[model samples]
Target: MPDVQIRPVTADDRSAWLPLWKAYLTFYKTELPDAVTDSTWKRFLDSNEPTNAALAWQNGKAVGLVHFIYHRSNWSINVSCYLQDLLVTPEQRGTGMGRKLIEHVYATAKKAGADKVHWLTHETNTTAIQLYERIAERPGFIQFRKPL
Candidate 1:
């Protein structure tokens, strides 16, 4: 793994993050319209917005992105961080960049005084789930979704 430098999202990263974000959605077979992408960039880049954060950088021009948020949980006494998405260009996958991205999420959660950090994956996503098992225990919870 090359020395991957992780940093917070910046206003200038919008250009770099878009294609990577689209690729991430594609990787999961999720479709995100262009307008939603524009809104997302605006929200995260807005200094006053509290709902989003991201880590961005490149491995020799390949982008890596991790988007996360903190939320209140009724069962948890303290706030929790939810890792909404994590992506590394396929070229960066085996280079330990994914783990590093996850670790950055954990560290950010800790620094923010969150009691826990969690995320869900498709049951068939064994590769990511396997990596997750090492850094955090899997909490058995089946996710359900309905379009509004």
Candidate 2:
């Protein structure tokens, strides 16, 4: 695991962080303009959005990020942590940082009083799917959505 530590991201990380962010977007085939990224980077700094979190190097390089949010759950009084984004730099992947990062979030969620941590991954994301299988049990609830 090589002491992969997760900490709150900082403004200085922007340069190191952007490339991984782009790679993550490429992985999902989602596109966004620079302005949206511009605003989002600011939003996290504002601290109004607990929905945001990022992980970086203790020695000062960006290794990965996990964008999550805590929200009230229907079945439990405790909140839910929805892991919206997780990305580890390509060179760092498969070296166990991904697992460590998620484990990091699991511990964070628990400490934050979250009932559970949840997220969705494409079925074709076999690598991540394998990791998820090892790290946590699937809720077995397939997700579906549509625009109103």
Candidate 2's displacement at residue 60, Å, is: 3.4
Model 2 spans > 4 angstroms off: none
In terms of lDDT, model 2 sits at 0.82
lDDT of 1 by residue, 22-52 (tens): 8988888989777988888888877676556
- Model 1 C-alpha RMSD vs. true structure (Å) is 1.7
* lDDT tens per residue, model 2, 60-119: 677888878888878998899999889888788788888878888888889989988989
Clash count for each candidate, listed in order shown: 0, 0
Q: List the residue pairs that clash in candidate 2.
A: none
Question: At residue 77, what lDDT does model 1 achieve?
Answer: 80
Residue-level error in angstroms, candidate 1, position 94? 1.6
RMSD of each: 1.7, 1.8
